[model samples]
Target: MFNLFVDSLIILLVVVDPVAVAPLFAALTHGESAATKRRIAIRGTSIAAGILVVFALAGGTLLDALGIGMPAFQIAGGALLFLLAVDMVFARHSGLRSTTEREQREAETKKDISVFPLAIPLIAGPGALTSVLLMVGEQGDDPFVIGTVLAVILLVLLVTLVSLLASARIMAFMGETGANVVSRVLGVVLAALAVQFVLNGWQEGFMLIEENASQMLTV
Candidate 1:
C-alpha cells in the first residue's frame, strides 16, 4: 500500500535526520567557498545514497542468511535509537563523533567534508543503519515498498543537497539555539521509538518460542 511507503519514509527521515546534519555540514565547510560547499554536499549525499541503498538492498538478505529474526533486530535497533536519543537530548553528538581530531584531519585533507562526516556518520550513522535493518526486515521482499523507501531516500538526499546549497541562509535562520532545540525534541522522539523497538523484539521472540513449543506438542 502507498501508506506502507509513507510509514517507512517517515521512520527513515526521523532516523536519518538530514536536517540535523545541515549544521554539521556548515561546520565542516565553514571556510570553504560557496562553490566548494555545493560540491561537497553533492558528493557527500551521493556517496551516502550509495551506502544506504546497498544496505537497504542487502540488509534483508544478510539477516535472513544469518537467521536473525525481526524481533531480535527490533530490540537491537530500539536500544541504539534510545542511546542516540539520550545523546541528542543532552546536546551531545548522538555518538556521531564527527567533530573529532582524526576525522577533522580527514575532513581537511580530503576537502570533502560531505563524504566524510556529513555523509558517513552524520547522515548514515549507527542509528540510521539499525533503522534501515529493521525497515528492510519489516518490508520483507515487497518490491513496491522497497521502491517507495528508495524514493523517499532520494527525496531526502535532494533536501540535503538544497540545504547545503543554502547553508548560509539556513544557519542565519535557525542559529545555534533553534537547531539544538530541534535536536533535543527529535531525541525525545527517538528514545520513545527505541522503547517501542525493544518491545517489538521481545514480542517477536516470545511468539517464535510459542510457535516452536506448539509444534513440539503436536509432534
Candidate 2:
C-alpha cells in the first residue's frame, strides 16, 4: 500500500507536471490582475480535479464497455506515456501533454480559458487522463487502493493549483532553463515507469495466452 501510494504519487506528478505548467500558466494569464489570475487558477484546477476524479473512477468501466482488456490498455497507455515522456525530455510541445499551436492561438483569443486549454488539455490532458486510468486499472477493485489513488490525484491537483497561483514566482525562480532541466529529469523517470507498464502488460498477456492454451489442451 505504501508502495502504491508512492508510485501513484510519482506517476501523477510526472504526468500532471505542475512545475512545467507554471510557466505556461504565467504566459496565458500574462498582464492579468492578481485577483483574476487567482480566479482562473482556482477554476482551472477545480475543473481539472473533477475530470481526473471521474476518469479514475469510471475509466475502467468505460474500457470494459469497449471490450478493451487491461493488458492491451496497459500496453497502449504505456506507449502513449513514453511518447509524452520523450516530449518532456526534449522540452517539446505535443498534443499528448500540451496544447497544439493552433490551440494556443485559440486560447489567446478566448477570455476564459479555464475549460478549454487549461482544464481539458493542460491540466487533464491525454497523458494525465491515461495515467489515471492506468493507475486505477492496476488497483483493480480494491477500494482502499483505489481510494489511495484518488487521494493522490487530489493531492497532485492541489499542488498544481498552488503552482498556478504562484506562477509568476515560480517562473522567476525556475525560469525556462531550470524548468526544462527539471522536466528532463522527471521525463527519464516517467520513461522508466512507462517501460515497466509495457513489460507488465506483455507478461500478463503471455500468461493469459498460456492459460488459454492449457485449457484448450485439456478440452
Candidate 3:
C-alpha cells in the first residue's frame, strides 16, 4: 500500500507539474484583483482536476478496447509531451491568437478572463493529458494505489491554489525576476520527469520482450 501510494504520488506530481505552472499563473492573473484571482484559481484547479480524473478512470480501459499496447502509447504520448515541453521552453503565443484576442476584447468589456486562456490550454493542456494516460497505464490494476495517488493530486491542487491565493505576497517578495528563476527551475524538474516517463516505458517494454524471448527459447 505504501509503495503503491508513493508511486501514485510521484505520478500525480509529475503529471500536474504544479511548480512549473505557478509562474505562468502568476503572470496570467497579474492585474486581476484578489477576489477575482481567488475565484479563478479555484475554478481553474477544479476544471483541470475534472479533466484528468475522468481520463485516469477510463483511459486504460479505452486503450485496451482499441487494442493498443503501452509501448506504442508511450512512444506517442512521449512525443506529444515532448512537443509541449518544447513549447513551454520556447513560450510561444498560443495559436488561438484570434480567439484569444476576441476573448480579450470581451474581457475588456466585462473584466472576465478566467475560462479563456487561463483554464483550458494552460492548465488542462496536452502535458496534463499525456501525464494522465501514462500514469494510468503505469498504475495497471492497482485501484488502491490509483485512488491514493489521486487523493494526493487533489491535495497538491489545493496547495497550489493556496499558493496562488498568496500570489500577491509572493510576487511582492520575489518580483518578476525571482518568479522567472523559479519558473526555470520548475521547467528543469518537468524535463527530468519527462525523461523518467520515457525511461520507465522503455524499460518495461524491453523487459516484456526479454521475457517473451526466454519463454519461446524454453518451449
Candidate that scores best on TM-score: 2
**What lDDT tens digits, residue by residue, belong to model 1 across residues 1-219?**
677566567666767776677777777787898788878888888988888888889988888899888888888778878878888788776564245778666776766566668777877777767776776666658887677767877876787678778777878999989878987887787788779779978988999899999999999
Model 3 residue runs over 4 Å out of place are 1-32, 82-110, 207-219
lDDT of 3 by residue, 5-101 (tens): 5655664554454554565566666677778888888887787778767777887888999988787788777766555554444543333211366
lDDT of each: 0.77, 0.90, 0.65
Query: Model 3: number of clashes?
Result: 0
For candidate 1, list the clashing residue pairs, or say none.
none
Candidate 2 per-residue C-alpha lDDT over 1-219 given as tens digits, one digit per residue, 9 for 90 to 100: 888899999999999899998999888888889998899889999999899989988898898899999899999999999999999899888678687788888997887888888998888999999999988875658899779888999899999999999889999998899999999999999999999999999999999999999999999
TM-score against truth, every candidate? 0.91, 0.97, 0.74
Candidate 1 TM-score over all chains jointly: 0.91
RMSD of every candidate to native, in Å, equals: 1.8, 0.9, 4.1
TM-score-better candidate, 1 vs 2: 2
Collision count for each candidate, in order? 0, 0, 0
